[model samples]
Target: MEIYQAFLVALVACFGKFTGDIGYFMFDRPIVLVPLTGLMLGDLQQGLLLGAELELVFLGIVSIGGATPADVNMGSVLASAFAISMGAGTDVALALAFPIGVLLQMVKMLIYFFRATTMHKVEEYAEKAEFDKITFMHFGHCAIYVSVYGIIAFCSLVFGADAIRSIVEAIPQVVMDGLQATSNMLPAVGFALLLNMLWDKKLAILLLFGFVLSSYLQLPVLAVSIIALTIGLIMIAQDRSSSKTAVQTTGEINEEEDFFNA
Candidate 1:
């Protein structure tokens, strides 16, 4: 790509990723933004694949209590673009992306730490109940965050891509093998995290049903999802029926007591 084109691409990619990051924070998802980045880069297929894999890897990852998790947006955008640009496979891209994502997370944590320092001013404003000052503080903090992201994006475009490609090309076969090995192991990590979220005893039967359907019956995910939806509807109907019966029984008991009192 020409220097001007590269700059344009970088700016657009950065803005797309930034938008995605904001969406992730609000909607708790990064998948929506990855495809947009890919589309901007003229590689929608690679973008979709990268997004899906990243989503799986971070399936159980959540930001709770102001904690930062891995920066999925940066990871997906950088890795997907690099992968498509370099003609690398999905697995290789994923292998490279995971660590980069974690590094981005660290960067984000540092940003958050700086933002925290500014929060004291907001707190002081709150003490005076100056709502406008509190609002300005929030806006100022967000502007700083977005500006930092834009700078990173611009710098990465200007200096990072060629260097990254050179490094990947120069990597030894042994190291490449190690990356592949790590890539293979990453899905297990993702699954383990998902298991943590879905370990409920009450949902054990449904889980088993899905497992059996997928593993033994070899059903497609679409088929399994449909079955699960049907099961959910049935269960909901049964619960409603039971609730109605309970209400009727309670009403009869109340009537009986009233009649006896009369």
Candidate 2:
């Protein structure tokens, strides 16, 4: 990639990273980030497909409190950038994404550790009733995050892309094939993880229904989704109707009791 292209890619990465710091706009998601990176890299279609694949790969991974999950946004951004720039396929992107994400996670942890020190200053400002200073510290930290990670991404693209390409080229075809197989299975694993977290016997039927539609009927995803949505709306309406009937019955019983007492 050219320097300007790399710079633009870095900007995309920074935007992804900064999404959380600003608010939960969810621009950091691989589904969003990879396509933007791809657009910057001049391969929107490839980026879109890769983004969807990467989204599945990172689907169940989430950050909770101090436990930071892998940096999916950064990883996806770089992976798509590399893939598009090299005219490579999803296999290479998948092979590179996890390590890149983990590396960025480490960087995030370090950044958070150092950024924690600013809390002391924030507390001091809070005590002094210096609201402006406290606010500055908050936004200033966000700015720092953007600048630091943006530079890291910029450097990675300009410096590491060639090195990575060389390494990938040196790998044996058998290993590349193995990576491709692993990549193909990752979406299933991601879904499994999601199901493990959200497993409910009552809802399992719905899951099976969707599965049957997709697998046996060979229905498209949109059709299955619409069917599910219709079912959900019907269920919700039934529940509301039941509640309303119960309320009416209770009201009638109360009126009867009052009439008898009078």
Candidate 3:
């Protein structure tokens, strides 16, 4: 990649981190970042396709509390950069993204680890009523967190791109096929993970209905979405009617009880 292109990738990575700091607008997602990275690299179409595919793999990943998921932002940026700049395929990008994300997640933990160790300073500031210093540390931490990822992005693209391309060129056909197969299966895995988190007995019937519509009846996604929306509206209306009836019944009972007392 050219120096300016590499710088742009790093800049995009910085923006990805910035989004998370400022209320998580989801600009860091693979689907969003990859296209932006691709645009910077002059391969928007490939970036878009790869970004869509990568989104499936990372779809179910959510960082709850202190837990860190893979660094999708870093992985998507670098993988798309390598794939675009090196003229590699989507499979290569998919193969590259997950491991890279997983590996970089450790770096994220280290950042968190150091930040955690500094809580005492914040505590001391709080005890001393140094609110300004505490505020300064918060912004400083955000800047440092964002810059570290940006530097990683820039260096990885500039320094590591050639090495990765060379390795990709040397890999055997069988291994490549395996990687492609795995890539194909990853979306299902992502969906399964998401379902595991969201599963409820009440929603199982709806899930099956959508599955049958899409799988058996060959209904398009738009049709299924509209059907689901209709069902949801019906359910909402039923609940509202039930609530009104119960309220009216309760009011009648209260009035009858007061009449008897009088």
Q: lDDT for every model? A: 0.72, 0.89, 0.89
Q: Write the per-residue lDDT of candidate 1 for residues 1-262, one digit (tens) a residue.
A: 3455345545554565455445644332436555655676677887677677666666777767877777766666667666777777666677666677798778778878998877878878889999998877776766677667667756765678788888888888788888767766776787789888768898888988899999999999899999999999999999999999999999999999999999
Clashing pairs in 3: none
Write the residue-wise lDDT of candidate 3 on 27-81 in tens digits: 8898999999999999899889889888888899889987877887678788878
TM-scores of the candidates are 0.77, 0.89, 0.84
Best by TM-score: 2
lDDT-superior candidate, 1 or 2? 2
| Order of quality (TM-score) | 2, 3, 1
Q: Which ten residues in a row have the lowest lDDT in candidate 2?
A: 64-73
In each prediction, how many residue pairs overlap at the backbone (N, C-alpha, C within less than 3 A)? 0, 0, 0
Candidate 2 lDDT, tens digit per residue, 48-126?
Answer: 9999999998889988777878887788889888888899888999888889999988988888888997699988999
What lDDT is reached at residue 128 by model 2? Answer: 93
Over 4 Å off, model 3:
65-67, 226-262
- Please list the residue runs of candidate 2 whose C-alpha ends up more than 4 Å from where it truly belongs after superposition: 235-262
Q: What is the Cα-based TM-score of model 1?
A: 0.77
Error of 3 at 95 (Å): 1.5
For model 3, where is the 10-residue window of minimal lDDT? 66-75
Candidate 3 positional error at 155, Å: 1.3
